[model samples]
Target chain A: MSDKGMNLTLKIWRQKDAQSQGKMETYQIADISEHMSFLEMLDVLNEQLISEGQEPVAFDHDCREGICGMCSLYINGEAHGPDRGVTTCQLHMRMFNDGDTIYIEPFRAKAFPVVKDLVVDRSAFDRIQHSGGFVSVNTSGNTQDANALPIPKDDADKAFDAATCIGCGACVATCKNASAMLYVSAKVSQFALLPQGKVEAKDRVMNMVKQMDLEGFGNCTNTGACEVECPKGISLDNIARMNREYLKAAIDK
Target chain B: MSVVSEDTFNSTSHFMGTNAVVQFVLQPILAFGVIFHLSMGIYLDTQNNKARSVKYAMNKPGTNSSWMSRNMKITGIMILLFLGLHFYDFWIPELNTKYIVGDMSGLNEHGGMRYFEELQHKFADPIWVILYVLSFVFLALHLLHGFQSAFQSVGFRHTKYTPIIQKLGNIYAIVVPLGFMFIAIFHYVSQL
Candidate 1:
């Protein structure tokens, strides 16, 4: 163990299948570097498991740059680890101390069934996006100059911010209802703000909401947890926009 | 022989008319009333949060309500579930047996009665009755916090209006659930 390193304990969730029982197994790692990312610490621990002839823990990770959003961990009852506006992969081990006990578990939701250990089926999100997350454009010659549309700066900035959503399931994982409104709203707002998407706006909101309900995902309670846990700091304003769009679309129908 | 048939026909027609009034006219109006008040309350609260955020200049971190209070999505989900079960137990079967399955000119599935028989039958099961009452309890909890919070969020925290709104919210929170509970218990005991 290095002089600057710390010893830590981990209680991780282990489950083989959806129908199988899950239990928390504890492991101890000594001399962990504070400068290492949280995922790197997990890698060191996995190496020990492999050398010890034990099966390694199953978890998801891709694009550790925080764009892919495949890495998700609930650390000490906080979603996406203890930090705000940072994903599990981005969280550093320096946030903790020596001899600290960390409870690591996969995001729990009925809609997001656990596929392996830490991996959950977030295809429900993909389904919601498919419902109405795109602008309806036929491949044809550009009709107007980009600046000719003249979108207000405020609206453009809001749209760009909403577009920053990485389609991560962190919002759903942290939400008490497992609601996807924040993510869905971001997708809806991204298009609804631009003139190119105005033509299909009505159909978009209606179909998306209908699909959301049908997916067995819970409705938005407006608790703002999704916004809080979002790594990109997606605002709840997009949800408000979604509500307004849903109302108008519903009334028109 | 002719008198008996005429009497049956009159009774059947009367029941059918009342069922139509309750199912189509009354229930929908009540549902819409709930939706309107609740949506307005939510919108007002949202606006209030926005104004408060601007006033504070920076985000207010970890200064909100408890998990349950913060998460109204869970409550909305429960309400939606109850609505589905309620519609299934009462509206669907009523519409099906009375208008669809059985002839409108004759006695419906549960005899020549509408509210009394159907309500009683649905509430007869102890589990069903318990579930309905529990759902109302959840609704009351949600409304109590939501109503007051909504008013306060919309800048209604005045000396006079605040108390009045709080009182009204309390009354509303209690009365609505109690009324529904009364109906559920009434039907359940009637079966016994």
Candidate 2:
């Protein structure tokens, strides 16, 4: 009590597997230092559970500094806890108060199903990327030199902004309709803005959008929730760009 | 103004009843537009619901998006309900008189042009006027998000123009509903 260690309650989703039902289970922890990251707090809870001969909570994390986009959670109804522009791993224990009850659950979408306690199968994102999220690179000794084509500074910066999206399902998880338009648009705009990407932009947008829809993601109603919950600060402008790109491609075809 | 001004109301009503373009072309087009918008809204909402079949245990939607954007379904359904009452009040009776009853005279029993009187009578009752005013409020709520959203849906965002479109959308949402509410209130108050 003299050390000022925080006492907290954690309510975590517990699911045996994808087919089994899940429920929120609560755990109480004491003496948690405020300096630890949110993941570290969960680590302490998991260690305690193991020592008590109980199964530990299962969650996903990698590159705890927040670049990999591997960690995804719906904390207390938010995509990555209460903080803005930070992933769950980047979230700190200082954000929570002593005796606070924290709720953690996996991101929910028809396209993202639970794999374990807080691990949902986000491979749907991968399939959408596979559809056309890349540029056709020439590697047969005929590749054009980099910067051969001049890109407008504004376009380059915007493309870089769109390029920062880590493919995390936060946008999808946060959207009411579970729309992936922001994510798909970011992928589309990254290339659409650049000369290299513009060559095949027509097919890229069309195929990627088709794949996105086939994965059972909802259509965008332009609520713009995805931008607010995005850890990378992705803009709603990307979704608008994607909509325009899709329309242009549809018309041209 | 039109409701209180009998001359303006009757001539407009008479022109509307007798004009082939208004009766055939405009009315059908308006009806189709309503049906398309209503059915599409319902279909999209149903699909949106299916996207997340499992409900969140403890989540807050208000932190991220506007209330109007989040609750389009509620506002849209309210507008639909009002449309039903509107059809019952005006359209059904108008159609009955013009078609089923075989009268296209657009005149009252005393032949003084019934359009103004009929419109006035609807507002004479506080309940009907209140219903109309309330419906206009819902219409404003629906358009607040919808006006700008349609442009986004169509991929029409320009750095210079998007802001203007958003501003225009807000103005349109406010002005259109306010105008309708004004008509309802003006009629009701003038009679009083």
Candidate 3:
């Protein structure tokens, strides 16, 4: 039952730039270990490429521990590879057959332009976060008592869940409209539930919506694809919350 | 005013002038005005139904009114009924005259139709006008909930942005329909 000496084929996308003509080049690897994480297999392949004086295929990975949110890859038509809820780094080679051909490609989005190969410039997400994502809390180490403001358990739980968004562009990549509503909503919800956020809530929604529109993100058709592909399973409820918040802001203004 | 020639000025003046009055104002108020509201209401209803099914499937069994889940279908249905009555009194007849009978009396010189005249004619009954105004009241209520809820459903209800969404909803609900109502009331009174 051990796959200590199995061969596999990798058909990876290769493009020089966003506008470059990209094609899938095939590579054959022999004697791969089933126990190797998907990324480790890539490391072994890279070693071989380097030994042959070939430029290793470029891909993004930082903190292979899966929390840094830097690893981005679409494997065989699934975001972050197969095995739901796990990022690409956590995927193991045991999931694949010995002679299977795995198709690997970069996450696609007009807003997320591809850099070299698997790497994409995800600064669009950063800009959206910068627009109106934070509360204007003074950083003077003014520690307020935690129990001074008692948020309902339900609200607190929802806030914590929304706050777990890691700013990965997977939602945007998976959405047919390329909508960032899920990401934006999570940011909005995180602040909205707390008393500290209520003071600037109105301006935040307005500014964020204006920024979202300005960023050329397609309108949300509510296909629910983003939720399905999201690594954290961020729900569509957050999108609903954002819509309500935006409407409230508009009326107040 | 100068004295008009007996041959030039005929008995048709009063009737022609009345027809002109009807064409300029009554037609569009009945036709497009009602159709616009009705179509919008129907569209909202469809969207609401979709949101309802989605929420129903997603919601846990014992959870209480979770804002967006509680309101989408109800608000959508209320808007649909509001627009239905609005159309029954105004749009149906106007459309009948404009399309089926090939009547252009309600239209203006710019080829744009005047709806106020038809509204006045219909609302002269008082019962129908009251019904029309009632529909608008419901429309206002529906918009009040819908505008804010749609954003929330889409995850726009952030701490910083939620208040803004609420404010915008209130304005849309109050201002747009109230403007239409003002015109409706003005025309109805002038006819009396």
Candidate 4:
């Protein structure tokens, strides 16, 4: 790809507040560096907006790296832009052509209401986390030995895979139903597959799933869009495992 | 309930596609998947409703997911209902004819025409034909989401092939249900 700068068109969503009606405002950026990250390009555009005495577009980002799960944007009909398995921060301008008209929109979901322009209030994720995303243990130093327990290799690997979920709303944003099954299942599987998490296993699946439902997210239709757009490449098997856990808990109850 | 209900036991008599490979190996796994999927669906539906205790004043789900994806539970419930009627119509009678009546003549005879005639008989009535067609519509909707979803659930996805899988899913969703609907309509028209 060329490192030369190029002019581009951007269609960004703008809203006054959460209650206000939102619309796509078009802006043109001239000579944006092709090597810049997608968010960096937006930063340059914001700088230009400030210089022009115009309100800058609002968006979300924490770590410039992909790990924090704070960077969320729906770019050109795909979550986190055209790049596969990367968040918005990782999306380089090289992915787009010189004169490309990129459409940037906030993650749309019932559970995720737009707080401003591209920043939606994602605390629905927090409530879900609170609903049993923890393990109970003695806070005192009398904890069990780390190597005391034995975990099967496959189970440990699967648990590690599930634990990589960053609780980003990308799964909900990408889902047609805006369902949080991927996120919830990841949380559930992380605990369900672990011996330490076995203490709250039943309640974990039941409560987390219940809270996820209560967040006004749409049901998972199993379209597989969430997995496709997930930055961490989390598997949908976690969801199946969650279903199994829920079923076992429900039967027991 | 019985470990294997009379319904399931009766249904097993007509496992026509379950050759040695399917019967001995795949059938059990498929059955577990179907049962688990249905049960999980019911629980998930309840949880989904609970999650969205307050409906959004305005929701534009079209922006994110497909229509089939959004309405899977509705279609799934409809399919479950259709399955009950299906088992009643064919599986139960097949069991009765084979075991209860001691007349195995119609059992797997006429190259499975008895089964064909059973379908024709059900579709002959306009009400049944409408119900059958409607069930296929729900079936199509369910399959539209379930087909590709099965692949994703099992952790199989590729940028190069995911689009192809989705396209194939759409084709299967349309063709299979449409084919079943046509069969029902054809039988109804033939009788008329």
Top candidate on DockQ is 2
Model 3 DockQ reads 0.09
lDDT of 4 by residue, B2-68 (tens): 1224344334534543246765578579879889988987776675555433233223345445778
Better of 1 and 2 by TM-score: 2
Write candidate 3's Cα lDDT for B65-145 as tens digits.
Answer: 223333434545665675676567555765586668877465546654344333446656776666657667766766776
| Pairs of colliding residues, candidate 4 | A176-B65, A213-B51, A214-B50, A214-B51, A215-B51, A216-B51
lDDT leaderboard ranking: 2, 4, 1, 3
Q: Write the per-residue lDDT of candidate 2 for residues A153-178, one digit (tens) a residue.
A: 99999999999999889999999999
Q: Please give me the total number of clashing residue pairs in predicted model 1.
A: 2
Model 2 - which docking category? high
What ranking emerges by TM-score with the best candidate at the front?
A: 2, 4, 1, 3
Native contact fraction per model: 0.02, 0.78, 0.18, 0.20
lDDT of each: 0.74, 0.91, 0.70, 0.80
Highest lDDT, which number? 2
lDDT of each residue in B65-156, candidate 1, tens digit only: 25445645567668878989978876576567656876454454556644444445677888988898988888887887788766533323
Off by over 4 Å in 3: B1-192
* Real A-B contacts recovered, model 4: 0.20
> Which 10-residue window in model 3 chain A sums to the lowest lDDT?
A216-225
TM-scores of all candidate predictions against the true structure: 0.62, 0.97, 0.60, 0.67
How does the DockQ of candidate 2 come out? 0.81
Tens-place lDDT digits, model 1, residues A1-253: 3448889999888879877767788999888998898999889999999999998888889988789978877776666777778889999888899999888888766667778767778887788889898876766786566688889998899899999998777777676556778888899999999888899999999988888767666656556678878999998778767777877887899
Which pairs of residues collide in candidate 2? Answer: A77-B59
Interface RMSD of each: 13.5, 0.9, 11.3, 6.0
